[model samples]
Target: MLIDFLEFMISASNDSYIFLAGISAVIGAILPLSTIIFANFYEKSTVQTNDLYWELKREVNNSKAFIEGFNKIIYLGDNREIFNSTLKLFKLISYILILLWVLVGVGYIANVSKKPLDSFIISCSTLALISLLIYLPRILSRFQRELPIKVENKSCSINEIYNIFDVKGKGEDKLFYEEILVPTLSIVNTNSKLFIRYNQNLPLNNYKVFYSIQNKNKERLFINIGLLIKNKDFKNIHYTIGNEVSNTDTVQNKFSSIPFGIISKFNEIDSKNSFIYILDSLNQILYTGEVKCIFNSETKISKYTIKTYIDKSPNGHISKLLQNNEKEVHLLDDQQKLTPYYLLDYN
Candidate 1:
């Protein structure tokens, strides 16, 4: 009886091993095929993303060219419509592509070969979700575009102003005037060497400052003042100013000092308000301030400007200030004021 029981146990063990081997063989075959399918889907999604990206780029270049040609401002409205539409589509597609790849990774971890029917259902559901996401944004963007948007040319008053100067001669015969926009109203003496410390809370590192001068005739001149970058330690910020002649042109006279008046006409704009427009690389205005000349006995010695701009636009803080508007918008609570210190005193 003991010999018969042992023989029965051995047969059961052999049957179990055979069943396990069959399962493994099925899994091994299914996994490779599933992997190939996922890989193909990933490759297609990547190709679609690349194609959309290039299309978006082409649209941007066309819009830029239209603006540079000084075409009617109405054409700009049309370009914006196209740009927003393309951008929304591009974003949605990119997000769905990422999600699809993540789903493929999850399938491998979840042992999807064991449940082929469930895996197929999941893939179909993912594709449906991607389609829905891509379609919804288009429908919404179109609806929004068709709706009339009343954009008010709102003007805001400056909460604080800072007077910064670099004086060489006594009072009137100063050759150059440099204006530095700080968050705080700290008095900087040109005679003494001081380290200008920016407020850490101020979003200067993300923006590029442009010195804009408009003459009495309303002709505007824009200068790329400088951009503030974080130091290696990320504790302090440094200013890097350069003048770009054109898209393909480069100048050798890259100086650290903010060139207030490279053109003599820039100094002659005493009758009009000189504006310091803070913008990102995309030409979106983040802040706007007026540069007022301080005349001492009919000699323009110093200049001062307000430190903030209107935060009305959706993409940026401010768009533009209405000319001669009495309505005043207050400064945002989150805006930080800058403080300047002596360079030797900085730790």
Candidate 2:
């Protein structure tokens, strides 16, 4: 009986087979097209606010609204269990319809001709369609990933300096100094080797040294100096900070030898002022030395330095020198040996 039915299908008229295949193809095409249209509508209905903070707050406050709206669009107000069941049923129906379409298309092609050219064309078309279906999601995801992120334009100014550094007033009455910790994490961008030297032995309590700030996870937060210092702050303190090694001949990479330093403050009082050590890299530090304020009466400039060896440990921790007279002398000798190291000098 099955063989007789197969024989009847093979001997059937091309017109009848073509009509059946066309109808099946149209119905199969419409189901997926309607699915796409409904999927787009579902996407539009679930559009989220651009601000992540506000969007999360809104969701937390009115979580049910999202669920209800999503259900109304995707499942026609049905619960998740019912929606899932219906989805499985629809998928099964789609698969069945696709199988039927392929079977009908093959039957129509067979009825029309027994030629190799016709079979080759049908096979190529089916393979191409399958390939398109397989890769369509990946292509769409790639398109979304390549979209540019929107960022608000921030105008650069000197006031931004206050935002970068933690400023505090120290002292009382007639004389006072502003103690600031300019976070080296944000400002150090150059590949240059930064050296902080204590030109004179003043006091360790007065000056700020290069330090690292880590989060709860113990990860360092990195920031671009170019973005932070694109204003008057760069111009005002550019001379005080050196980004070049003195002896350029010994340095193979000239750009990498550019010295970098941070200016602590600009003040009229010579005795009260101090310089903060800005490192070339966030990980680098002044291992051992005391920073001192040496006010040049003639030059009217305050010079601050940490006469020390800058070294990194295996565990990513900076080694600190024992604060004593002997270590201080050793640090001075080390600084003298390190000829091309930069200093923090300000007028």
Candidate 3:
């Protein structure tokens, strides 16, 4: 069918030849323009940089081995060199094909004008151009893989806020509570200030902390606390846990600190204690810590302190799920240790 079409084009009258040349000229012009348009659209579709890229960029700059491996894999290595060479070759061939098509159209016009010498010179360009077009699809079929520049690792930490208070008996036997120091939660991040925010992938349902009050008889009272970290600018890295307004059912700004108070009966004995267990969305324990409460019977006061003591390292399933075979990227903080009350000292 292609051979018959070429023969028909060759045997056509001068006017018909000119018309065919006009069509080829339009196609020659449109091919590169269409390619440029598609390239622009694809560039716009893929975002060049994001937070993950910036984070990785900082780490890549600090590690010599990592930077060397990354560049070799993504940019400066043999794979990239070969791809770049192939890209240049195909672009050169496409340009030659386009120029040859223009020459052929000009030859047809020259033939119609009765200039055989110019017609022959232009017609000679056709053989190379036709051969290139026949093999164009094969060369153009190869695609390149772009190296990834982003990595995201989500982590959560649980810290306890300690608040101390003094209690005194009033003249009418009424008890008055005095705030000594407001309890504030301290979230520990050694290398980066990355904290989990409720708005991001960190959801309130993923974790819950429990507080309890136990008397001498071992009777216990329990309270549930939800995790909600909030801040005006997420980039600032300083975040505070949002306090739930009692009974109003509305979220409020962070209080002076995480505050809890206990009122014992005139001679009742009780010990207040709290502990937090960090969990993923699937309810798997990631970390657990204790919040100690010290009661002062002589001074009629109490002290509450929380410290994370242990972190359950990733199990086999979690490690396998987070691993990617295509690229070797560092995501785990293996050196990170769970400390008791680390956030309190982290000013």
Q: Which candidate wins on TM-score?
A: 2
Model 2: lDDT equals 0.32
Per-residue lDDT of model 1, residues 1-347, tens digit only: 99875444333333443454465357435643443444444344444433443343344324344223211222222333444545454455446454543444344325433577766765675566566545644543442332111111111011101111222122221111122224321212232222222222112233444444445444444333333332112123333223322244333343223223322233345333455555443455545555553323343332334433422232222233222111111121212221111112234
Give per-model TM-scores: 0.24, 0.27, 0.24
TM-score of candidate 3 versus the correct structure, residues matched by position: 0.24
lDDT of 2 by residue, 1-347 (tens): 99987775555466755675577478557755554555454333333212332332344324454333222322321122232343454466546544544555566667665789887887677556545544543332221211011111211232222222233222120011112211221122223333222221111121223322222222321111221222112312221224334444343443343323221121121211112223222223222222344445554444443322222331322223211111111111112232222333334
Model 3 lDDT per residue over 83-189, tens place: 34444655775666565455445536444546777666556656556665556534443333342431111121221110001211121111100111112222222
Write down the TM-score for model 2: 0.27
Ranking by TM-score: 2, 1, 3
Give RMSD (Å) of candidate 3 vs. truth. 19.2
Candidate 1: clashing pairs of residues: 183-338, 184-338, 195-343
Candidate ranking under lDDT, highest first, comes to 1, 3, 2
Cα deviation of 96, candidate 3, in Å: 8.5
Q: Where does model 2 exceed 4 Å of error? A: 1-16, 49-90, 127-347
Q: What range of 10 consecutive residues in model 1 has the weakest lDDT sum?
A: 155-164
Give residue 124's lDDT in candidate 1 (0 to 100): 72
